[model samples]
Target chain A: MTDLYGVVPEPLAFAARDWGDLAELMERSSSDLGGQGVGALAPSVQAAASAFLTAWAGYAGESAAIARGFSSALDALVADATHTDDAIDTHFGGIDARLGPAR
Target chain B: MTVTIEVPASQPTIRRPEGQPGGSDTLAETLYTAASRYEEFADEADQLLAPRGFSGQGQNAYQAAGGKAAGEHRAMATTVERVARAVTAYADTLRDLLREWQELSDRQDVLDDRRTALIADINATTDATEAQIAALRERASALAADYAELVTDHDGLHRRVRANEDLLRQVFESATSLDEALSADGGVPEFAQQAMDRPGAPGSGATPEETRAWWEDLSEAEREAVVSSYPGLVGSADGLPADARDQANRVLLDDDLATLGSKADDGLITPAEQKVLDNARAAQQAMADADSFEDPITGERPGGQLWLYDPSAFDGDGRVAVAVGDLDTADDVAVFTPGITTEMSDVPGYTDQMQNLYESTRYNGDGSSVATMFWLGYNTPEGAIDWDTMTEGRAADGGERLADAVDGLRASRPDDPAHMTAIGHSYGSTTTSYAAADHDLDVDDVALIGSPGAGPADHASDFSVGQEHVYVGRDSRDFVAVLGDEGWIGKGGLGLGTDPSSEDFDATRFESEREDRGSTRLDGDAHSSYLAHDTESLYNLGLIVDGHGDQVNTASQSYDPWYDVPQDPEWDRDPSSGVPGQSQTRDPGQP
Candidate 1:
C-alpha cells in the first residue's frame, strides 16, 4: 500500500501478460464452441442452444474487454516506468559525459 | 377405410459421436481450463490493484482498470463454469443414451430367443387343444405388443438425446451469435483487412520483425477475427507467429478437406483437385499426429504448428513445414530439410523426428527455448535409383527456398535472434549444403546427416558460416552417405560434391552410430537413424543446435576409399592434410 519499494510493476506486468494470454484462450474457446457443429443435437435443439450460447458469449466478450483493459493499463504502467528510467538515464549520461571520466 | 400398420421386427439404431470424436473440440475440460485461467488471472491482477499498489498516474490507471477487469473476470469465470457444466450434462446424457440403446438392443435379442422357443414348443406339441393354441396366439400377440412398446421407447430415447443435446447446443449457439455480433462490429482490424487486400504493413515487403511487432500490437479478439477471415493467406504467410499460423492452417486444412471432399463426392473433382484433396488429408493427419504426440523424453505434449502448409505445391507433390515448438520465441531453432522421395505424406514421420531433435537440443542446452521444423519445401528427387538423383537442379532450387525460410526465421525476431541450425538428412543434407554455399543460408550452424553430397560445395569452407561451424554425421554402415564422394575427380556440390563427413571436407565430424540396427543398409535404415532417440548422433545434433558444437562427441573421419581400397580412419591418417584450425574435435565417443 505504501509503495516504498515500488515493487508493484513486476507483478502487474505478470498479471497483464497472463490476462493477455487468457483473453486469447477465451476468444478461441468461444469461437470453437460457436462455430463447431454439434452433430448430436437436433436443428431445433441447436437453435435453442445458440440463443443460450449468445448470451454467454456476450458476457465472455465483456469479460475479455475488461481483461484487455487491465492488460493495456499495465502495459502503460510499464511503458511509463521505462520512459521515466530512460529520461533519468539520459540526464545522468549527459552529466557523466560532461564529467568526462573525472567522477 | 381404415389404415393398418404392422409392428416392425427389430428396433432401428441411431448413431452419434462417442467419447470425443476426431477433430471435435467440444471437451468440457477445455472450457473448465478457460474458467480456471480466468480465475487465476483475475486473482493475480486484483491482488495488487485492489489495494492501489502503484504510485502516481500508474496507480490511478491500474486502480481504474482493476475494478471492471475483476468483475468481468469473475463473470467470465462463472460463465465458462456454467458452460462447462452444461457440456458435462450433455456428455452425461450421451453416455446414458448409449447405455439405454444397448439395453433395448439386448432386450430385442432376448425377445427373439423367446419367440423361437415358443415356436419350437408349438411345433413339438402334436396333440394340443384348440384352447391351448388360442392361448399361445394370445401370448404371441402380447410378445408382439411388448416389442412394439420397446420400439416406441427406443425412438423416444433417441428423441430425448436430441432434446438434451439441443439444450446444450442452445447455450453454445447463444454465445456464438453474440460473438458473431461482436466480430461484426469492427472485430476485423483495419490493418489486417488492408494486409489481406494488399500485401503491405508487416507482410509483403516488411521484415519478419516488423510483421511480428505489427501482429503483437493487435488485440486478441482482433487477431482471431483477422485469422478467421483470411485463414488461407495467414496460414501460409511467412514471418508470422507460429501458433497463429497453426490455428489458421488447421482451419484452412479443414476447409480444404471439406470443399474437396464435397466436390469429389459430387463427381466434379478434377485430377489436380483430387491431388490437392489427398495432400490436404496428409496435412490433416500430420496435424492430428502432432496433436496426439507425447514427448517421450520430456513427457510433455509440445503439440505441432503447421508453420507452412500448401496442399498443392511442387507439381502436386505438395509442400509443408511443421514446427514442434514456438518459433517466434525459441532461443534455438533448426530448419530440417529432408532429401529424396520426401512428400506431403512423409511430414508426420518427419515432424516426430524434429521433436526428437528438439528434445535432444533442449536436453543438451541450459533449458533454453528450442523449435525444430520438419521442412519439405522443395521438389525432391522422385527415386534414389533414378537419373534425377544424380543432378544438382533440384537441390539448387530447394537451396534457395531453404535460404528464404532461414532468413525469414531470422527476420521474424531480429531483436533476440535464435541460434539457427540448418539440417539436411540424406539428399536433404545435400540440399542444405547447397543452400549454405549458394543461397547464403542465414544460420549460425549447419549440420548434414547421411548426406549424399553437398551440391557445388567442395568443402565446408564454401559455406558462408565458415568451415568451423559445419557439422557432418554419417554412420559407417550408411552406404548412402558415400554417394556424395567426389571420387578422385572434382565434379560438383550436389551429385558430384565431396563427402561432408570425410577428412578432405574438413567439417566438424561427429560420431553417429554405425551399429547395423537395420536389416540392411540398402533399405536406408542406417541412413535414417541420425536423429534417433538416445543416440550419439542425435546427442551431437542437440549439442550443435544448443550452440555447444565444441562439446560434441566427435567421430574419426571416414573417407571414401581410394578407388575402392579401404582407407585409414582419421586417427591413422595424417591429420595435417585437411583439419581446419577452428574445429576442436571431441575425442571419439567423448561427451
Candidate 2:
C-alpha cells in the first residue's frame, strides 16, 4: 500500500540512487576525456583556450557537488520519517570531490 | 512559401574558406557527450520529484524547506541541461558552417569546369548548324544562372549563422544569471565584494601609475576574481603586468573569435561592426602567430599583449596595439605605424616585419632585451577615395593618439624608460610628424621611410628629436613620396609638405633604392620594400632604433633648383628624370 500523507523511503531511496548515478557520470565524463578534449581544441584557438575549459569544469564540478548535497539530504529525510511505513536510516557515502581547472 | 532576398549576382563571390582550424570534430564530440550527461541530470531529477514523490506529498509538504529546496534543485538541473544543449548546438553549428563552405566551394569548381567546356563547344560550333550554336548558347546561360544562385546561397548563410550566434549568446546569459542567483543565496561569494571597490578595477579610469599601484595591492584571490570577471578591462590596462594582461586579453580575444568570427570570412558585417571585427581578428592572429616565437637573444617565448583594443575607434576604422616583447623594461623599443589602408588586421604581418627589425637591432646593439610594438591606433586613410573625402583629418587624429600612447608608455615605466624610437612609413610619416610638431611626441629618434611630406614640421628642427636624430629614406622611383614636393601637388596644405629628403629640409638621407622598381604606381614593390631583410634601409633603421645612429651609411639628399634661383620658389622635378639603379655592393651581403 502506498501512503500519500507524508515523506517515504521508496522515492527517497530512488532519488539517492539516481543522484549517485549523476555524480558518477559527471566524474567519469570529466576524468576520461575532459583534458584530452580541451587540449585537442586548444591549439586551434591559439591563445587562452583554458577559459573555455574552466567554464565547463566549473559547471560539471558544481553540478556534481549540488547533486551530492541533495542525495545526502534525501537520506536524512528518509530517516526523519521514523514512525511512517517507509523508515530506513541510511547514509550513502560521498563521492570523491576533485576541484581544479580542467587541464 | 519562402521569401528570398536578391543578392547581387555581379560579385560572384564563391571561394573555399582557408585556414580551417584543426580539432573541431573532437570538441563537438565532447560537447555531445556532456549534453547527454546534463540531460540525465534533468531527467532523473524530474522523475523522483514528481507529485507522487516525497516532496509533493501532504498539505504540509508545500511548507517544508526540503520540498522547496528540491524544487530549486530541479529547476537548476533543467536550466543546466539547456546550457548543455545550447553549447552543443553551437558546436554543431560550427561544423555545419564549415561543411556548407566546402560544399558550395566544390560546386563552384564544377561550374568552372562546365563553363570551360561550354566555351570550347561554342568555338567548335563553327562547322555546325544554327541549332547546334543555339544549344551551346543555352548551355552558357544555364551555367551563368547556376553561379548566380550559388553566390546568393553563400550570402544567405552568413546572415543565418549570425542569427544562430545571437541565440547562443542569450542562452549563455540565462544560464549565467540562474547560476549566480542560486550560488549567491546558497553561500557567501567566493571573494569579498568590498575589495573590488578600489582603483584599477574595471571602469576605475585611473592613470597607469595609480592603476599599477592599486593592482599590486590586491590579494591573489581578488586579482583572480578581477581577471575572470572583467577580462577586457583588465587585459587592456597599461599598468597591469605583461603576463597577466596577456592571459586576460587571450580570454577576451578567444571569446570574440568564438562569438563573432563566423560571419567575418565572407565580409558579412555592417560597416561599423566590420571595423570592430577586423581589429579583433588582428589581435587574435597576432597573438596566435606570436605563440611560435622564441627570442634569439633570450630563449623566452611570450604571447603578444593587447595594449590597446578600441574597436570602432576611428569612425568605424578600429584601433589595436600589440607588443611582442616585455615593454615594461627593455634596452630598446620601436613603435611602428603603417600607411594608407592599414588597420589592425594587417598588424600581424607588420608584427613579423618588426621581429626582423628586432633581430637586426639585437645583432648590432649591446646585448640586452629589445621589444618591438605594432601600433595601428588610428583610422588610416584608405586609398584615393578616402584621400579625396578626408585626407589630412585622419592623420591629424592619429597624431594625437600616438602622442597619448607614448605618454602612457612613459607613465607605466617611470623609473626605467627604454630607448624608444618612432617609425612611420609613407603616409604614416606625416601622421608621426604631426605628433612631434603638435602633440610634442617624446621619443629618442624618428624614422620616416618613403615619406611624401612631414606635415607641419617641414624642417627637422621643428621636431622634438632634433635634426641630428631625424632620418629619412626615399626610393627615387616611388612617385607617391614625391607628393610632398610643393610643385607636384601644389602649394600650402594642398599636398603633405616639404620632402624630408630634399636638401633644404636637411634630414639624414638613407639609401632605400630596391632592385626592382615597378613601372607603375600600382606596382608598389619598391615603395613598400624598405622593411625587407638584408636591405640598406632596414639595416640603417636597425641602427637608428638601436641608438647607433652615427654608424649608418649616409646618402646625399636630392637637390632642388629652387635654391639656385635668388628669389626662390617651390621647384618641380620631372618624375622620369632620376638616376638608374646604382649597385652599392652588387648583391654583396651588407652585414
Error of 2 at B276 (Å): 4.8
Candidate 1, DockQ score (0 to 1): 0.13
Ten-residue region with minimum lDDT total, candidate 1 chain B? B574-583
Clashes of 2: 0
- Tens-digit lDDT string for candidate 2 (B1-591): 222222223335754332223454445344435544554555556555553445434324423533554555445444433333333334444455668987888888788788777766655544666676567657766877898888798886665455444444443443454454244221112342344577555457887778777777976545544554455677677667655565555545544454334333323334555667677777777776666666655657744566766666667666777777777777788888778888667868987787767766765566767777888888788784565313577778888888877876766677788898999888888889889878988899999888878887868888888889899887766666666753333444535787887776788877666555555555657678777766667777878888877777677777545445211111122221112222221123323
Steric clash pairs (candidate 2): none
In the range B1-591, model 1's lDDT, one tens digit per residue, is 222223235444534434332212354544555555555546655674754335777567667777656655655555554455445545544555677877887888887787776677666666667777777777677778878888787777766665554445544543344343233321232444654543333346766556666676765444544565456666765577777777667655655565456446534457987998888888877777776765444667667788888878878899899888778787888899998899997787887788778767765566777788999888999998767677677888889989987776776676788888998988888789889999999999999998877777888999989999999987766777766664465334334478888778889898676333443456547777787766667778888888888887777776555576434253222111112221212222323
Candidate 2 accuracy as lDDT: 0.62
What's model 2's lDDT at B580? 21
Error of 2 at B490 (Å): 5.8
> What does the lDDT read for residue B473 in candidate 2?
80
Superposed Cα deviation of residue B512, candidate 1 (Å): 1.6
Q: Model 1 lDDT vs. the true structure?
A: 0.67
